[model samples]
Target: MKIAFIGTGLMGYPMAKNLLEKNLELNVFSRTIEKAKPLEKFAAKISNSLSEAVKGVDVVITMLTDDDAVEKVLSDQDFQENLKKGSTIVDMSSIKPKIAIKYGKLLKDQGINFLDAPVSGGTIGAEQATLAIMVGGDQKVFDQIKDVLKVMGNPTLVGPIGSGQVSKLANQIIVGITIGAVAEAITLCEKAGVDGNKFIKALAGGFADGKILQNHGKRMIDKDFSPKGKVSTHLKDMNNILECAGDLNTQLPISNLIKDMFKSLVENGNDNDDHSALYKEIERRNKN
Candidate 1:
């Protein structure tokens, strides 16, 4: 099957490469043509225009940064018309569930299938094809494309229509709180003069151990501010969480605290750094 991939950024590039490596017919598009060049060795056709990239493709997969970019590509008249009936649009970006439902209905009316298939696991997960995918769509559609989803990650059909996005929002909430907890725990350890590395080792089999502690915990100890997942992205997810909670008339005290922490980091000009930089922010606050 021919697949068209849009937004070949950090996550998308590796995803599209995995699909191409599986020998699927692939067409790639990026806002900047340069970003699309790296995938040329996969022998897929590259297009500068969304219209050209999606035309005649059986599946259109989007891994953009936000809902606005997704809307921009989908609302392109040429792209809208070129997407054939029965074709599926898999949106892997983390966006609001309400927005996902609206777009899914719009595409359904046009005889196109839309799935809010948001993913977890960072760039490393995408590169390794081990990302966890939460899908929201018709069961039959998901069953049909299960193999395709597997090419990128282990995908689970969460529910119908907007369920995947809801699951993703939940995932973000857990990640936000976990990373924050990891940051605080490491900071406390450092202040107490305990070896952070040894702490991680001793806690490996305990309740304190988790993917967040292992992956981001190491970054905390070494003070690596490199962007695996940027502070801005987490802030965006926090905003979404707050908005979603308000709509549900629910309270998220812990997420609220994490949001404030991230806001402080962003306000202090660490928006482009990894979320693990929260440790540094905590250290800075302590020093002052």
Candidate 2:
């Protein structure tokens, strides 16, 4: 199908590349053209503007940063107005579920289908094309697009519009908490004068083994905090989780605690570091 993809950042870049590999009719756009440059070699045409990018495409995919970025881009009159009535817009960004619902309704009014299809598995997953995609939209629409999505990851329809974002928040909570767990576990090992790397290796064959321990745990002991997923990024999702919970009259005490940790992470000027950098915050607290 003809598709338009916007926001070619780290996650977007690899994802769009996967689509290009499938030879789907795809056009890409980035606020900074250089970010979209890598896709050009793979036959993805980089568009000059939002309107120019999305013009008349059957499916518009956006993998942006947060709610504000998502809103700002879709709010473009030319971008929305130019879409065909029966077309679909798939937002894979980690936005609030309620906001996704709002966008769903807004698109519905215009006779367009909208899907909140945020994903997990960071840039590594994006590059590996193995992300776990959680979708929220009409079942029929999801079925129709699942093939396209599967090109980049495994796609599942969790519920109605907004559910994807909610699901993503769940994923983030678990991810953030687990990262903290790994960090602290490693720190404990180091404090006991044991090698943190060996600690991970010792846990590998047991119940503690997990994707986080295998990947992020390795990053932690190695002191590699480069941004596959940034501290600021998960912080945004955690805050969105708390916001969603508050609106729903639910309590998420642990999520609140994790959100506060991320707050300190950003304040310490490591917001751009990988979310695994939660280890640093843990280190700070332990020092006190």
User: lDDT winner among the candidates?
Assistant: 2
Query: Model 1 over residues 67-163: C-alpha lDDT tens digits?
Result: 7988888778999988978999999998888989999999999999998899999999999999999999999989878899999999999899889
TM-score of predicted structure 1: 0.98
TM-score of each: 0.98, 0.98
Error of 2 at 243 (Å): 0.8
lDDT of 2 at 48: 90
Error of 2 at 80 (Å): 1.0
**Candidate 2, which ten residues in sequence have the lowest lDDT sum?**
196-205
Worst 10 residues of 1 by lDDT: 278-287
